[model samples]
Target: MDIEKYIRNIADFPKQGIQFKDITPLLANKDASAQCLENLLQLVGGQKIDKVVGIESRGFFFGTLLAQKLNAGFIPIRKPGKLPYTTLKESYQLEYGMDALEIHEDAIKKGDRVLLHDDVLATGGTASAACSLIEKLGGEIVQCNFLIELKGLNGIQKLKKHIVNSLLQY
Candidate 1:
């Protein structure tokens, strides 16, 4: 399936000099969404996943879908106090300052095989922070999955320790 064709590119969106690759167009089409999900699942390569840790909002979309398809528990890693529980947080450095993400302390058990997910891999700060939160809870990261990866940004450098895969790269 040509999933890239379904992606909507918006120039200078959400800020200046940023080209956003929107997935809503792909999400809107049933077959395209299903195909993309299948492609993402293929990235797992049949490995057993105990939990799927999805980042914030966009990650929640296919994150839950991947969990359901894998028959694993879905764990949401949110920003700040979005989760109503005893949470563990990990902060990361941004271009100007710092940002953080939180996960429920009990979200993952020791030795659990986890698949961390996000909609896009930008500067790698967000994903790296999410990885820290997973590690703090003792979950072994099986793979870091993303729908789109912007290679020009060099996000993969920060995630050098893990297996990274994406359906589409820009």
Candidate 2:
């Protein structure tokens, strides 16, 4: 669907030298959003997914839809204190400093197969931390999916143990 065309690039966004791949344009276009979701689903190849673990805010967009399509529960992995429940946290190194992500302690059951989704795979810290949270809760990661991946950042290196797929890479 040439989804990249729908992604608007903002230079030096949120910080200097950072080029943000904005998805707002894509979300605004119904057909592009649908096609992107469909492509993300294809990455699963009809695998049995019990839960869709979405990383914080952006992931929730397509993550919820993917969960619906897969008939799986949507689990949100958010910043510290965002979840109103007993939670499990995992900390990771970011460019600036260390950060943590939290998920409800009971979100996943033992042996549950999970599909992790995020908007972008930058340095892999965020997604990797989310994976740790899922594993700690006894969930098996089925696949780590993304809408966009910055290949130059080498985020995939941290996620080498699992199947990683992305709709677009820059």
| Clashing residue pairs in candidate 2 (N, C-alpha, C atoms within 3 angstroms) | none
TM-score of 2: 0.97
Candidate with best TM-score: 2
Count clashes in each candidate, considering only residues at least 3 apart in sequence or on different chains: 0, 0
lDDT of 1: 0.92
RMSD of 2: 0.8
Model 2, span 27-87: residue lDDT tens: 9999999999999999999899999999989999999999999999999999998999999
Candidate 1 lDDT, tens digit per residue, 43-96? 999999999999988899999999999999999999898999999988887533
| Model 1 root-mean-square deviation | 1.3
> Pairs clashing in candidate 1?
none
Report the CA-based lDDT of candidate 2 relative to the real structure.
0.94
Tell me the deviation in Å of residue 50 in model 1. Answer: 0.3
